[model samples]
Target: MIPKKLASSLLIVALALPGCGLVLENRIERREAAAEAAYPSEGRFVEVAGRRVHYVQEGRGPDLVLIHGASGSTRDFTAGFMERLTDRYRVTAFDRPGLGYSDNVSEAYEGPFNTRSASPAEQAAMLHRAAGMIGIENPIVMGHSYGGAVAMAWGLRHDPAALVIVSGATQPWPGDLGLLYNVTGSSLGGAALVPLLTAFAPEAQVERTIASIFEPQEPPPGYEAHIGAALSLRRASFRTNARQVTGLRPHVTAMSRDYPALRLPVEIVHGTADTIVPIDVHSRPLARQIPGARLTELPGIGHMPHHVSAGAVVAAIDRAARQAGLR
Candidate 1:
């Protein structure tokens, strides 16, 4: 026996919910359209296991595969850093699955409430298949931040000439990934809050996040515009990134045990001041794990060593090529 007033209130709330959902969906669609228009795909696509993988290929020398971090695209490399190496080595930059213009690994993984994400190994396998389609084989693979996990997976599952990890999150760290990832990655948050973020996240906030990622150093001129930060704000990209980052520790823990088995030339570049992926926790232990792995520590630099200290990164890559007997 429901009271008349209570029943009326419940009915009104139920009626309003659909309209609210409609508005949010409309806004999300508009924002996604604007983001794509401003920063369209900068490279061609190849089909890998029935999914589209976007990549940019340039220069001519040894095959070099570049994997950008979480929420990043090939644009991160194409911005300027890839150009620096073009004269010496052929470079191919890829947008990891579920980010940039690359399609999600599967439709099941795209659902807002779905907790499953493409693992680093899965991403590596897909991209490896795509690389094969484009004739890239036994090449030097480099990964930054989250992409480092994928690069390591590539090395373990397949053969690569060399590996360069920049500010990589290689080992499992203490504690969880904090509120943003934990919340956004959850089933409830992904379905309810993600659309709000996608629809209303401001440009200034994106700039601030970019600055934080490059903390202890400023982002280079036009870096924000070139990196296509807007792409990361789309509902799907945001949800997928949160899911991947939140669920990464367990995968890394499993992967870390296999690090000692890697027998290829490995170069690790990390900033001593990096708080995002602490050097002491990730790079230091990683340097000790791999056989004959070389580590280059940049004092006072932050997570983005490739952007802040491109010369050092290039030097490490050169050293890797030489060590691998490719030079």
Candidate 2:
């Protein structure tokens, strides 16, 4: 249950934003330092949907495409993870429609990233197009949370080498609007209540919450800066978040019906403790409904296990990849 006092307090904070933009200088300072440190600078930029997408590909073998969750960019899945896979498979992760450096089409009821990008079907198709643009044929596809839905939709239509989901929802999705409006609130609202949500120390907790997908409970010292950069430098980040809440709900519902027909070597991963997008809503049902799906539930992890529990997530991906005979 959301606290009345806290909600009211946050709303007051919301009243203060010049816009939903957070601070950027601090965040960029951190990314330039950490990303290059994690992997050599082989970042590739491409044009998709009338916008430029930032992506990173490493290693050489069967291609693996990663789709990130709502309001998240490819950065959510760091290059460090790619480094681990460097010797074997080629890995690719992209900025979703409105997030990151992708096209900023997150207007309410607008074209592209509005509802179209919100729909798993459309997103999956777009992701496939992006893959073709990058010249990756029959790439293994993977996604987390909302990204999981897009990946599932894509995998269903076409046979990927394999599908790996980390806390990925295979069925429909439900959004929390209270959380949505809160994100739309001013930067102060985000900062003040962020600590409240995570129970972390109060300073910059909101940014930490966003970055948590990449770093989880234990954030690297400068990651908070990246959150600020994402919120501030990138205009569409929060707009996309609100749109995900208002627009994606029905698409998720629509996608749920397709689970019975889900055919592929698929591995679904989730954390039972996930407060966001509970497993019961879709993941579990899809696991049961999809003819040959395998479910792996991580006991104490949360939604972003790839970031929160990297070792376990990587192991799961490796298992799924092996199951698909990538080795």
Candidate 3:
């Protein structure tokens, strides 16, 4: 016969599991509403490969394209770069697939969590088609962080006018991404924990993550609200982002081999103090690989150089424009 205490404990666990699921469901609905209210899509969309790619186009001059980082959207540009660059260039910023307002590629996972469309090359292909649909051709491509990898793929496949990489994950880094990425990115973890995070992760935790990303410099006032931190926590975004980050290294390895052959004028900007994508490991070696590539090292700056040093990024863009004779 089963002991009364053991049976009672088992019954409680069974009841609590379903109860937690119910709470999570309600939380997701509430959070989704809050997220939409916080950052309504201010951009237009173009369809490519059955996915709606969200993009914001502004300014009027030589065409320029901006691709944002991991867990980021076109709003990252709107946070600062879009306004500053719009005055001189026809700037278009795109939300990477499975992020922001962009439609995710539909696929059933063989395991718990993974993706076939989370690669930089695939994202580049999608955005390239969208660019053509929107009447942009041979524009300068600027990518920050993970977007830098996509920009590289764009240059390889579609021949951009120039390439600007800011704190880009250009080369393979040593070791794994440690516990946070592994745990969140795992199949079991993603399935079980992502919804919980999306439902209940505090705004303060989001603020802390943002602050950490821009370490050595604080987020400007209203940045947390403007950047739509809640959007990143959405279950779909969380899974897609995790898969993308987890699968990045292999893609970058193959992409790096082709860098030496790239003749397009490349501009690489990185901060010396950036721990995210170490300067020595990524940008420095990348600058050397690309023939005639220019490297600008900003002392004391961190990963979010696009926000921290917009002038420098703009200046680099100008140089690329001149080199490509877009001016």
Give the top-scoring candidate (lDDT).
Answer: 1
Q: Cα deviation in Å at residue 271, candidate 1? A: 0.3
C-alpha local distance difference test of each model = 0.88, 0.62, 0.84
RMSD of each: 6.3, 6.4, 6.1
Residue lDDT tens for model 1, 173-276: 99887666776788976776667777766677678778888998999998987988888888889889989898889999999999999999999999999999
- Give the TM-score (vs. native) of candidate 3: 0.92
For 1-327, candidate 3 gives per-residue lDDT tens digits of 112343344334434576577766887889988898878897999988677999999999999999999899988889876898888898999999889998875454223455433678888988999999999978999999999999999998899999999999989989997655665577755666566667767777678789988988888777777899788888788778878888899999999999999999899999998998899999999999999999999999999988988889999999999999999
Give the number of colliding residue pairs in candidate 1.
0
Better of 2 and 3 by TM-score: 3
Q: Candidates sorted by lDDT, descending order?
A: 1, 3, 2
Between candidates 2 and 3, the one scoring higher on lDDT is: 3
After superposition, which runs of candidate 1 have C-alpha atoms over 4 Å from their true positions?
1-18
Model 2, 318: alpha-carbon shift in Å?
A: 2.6
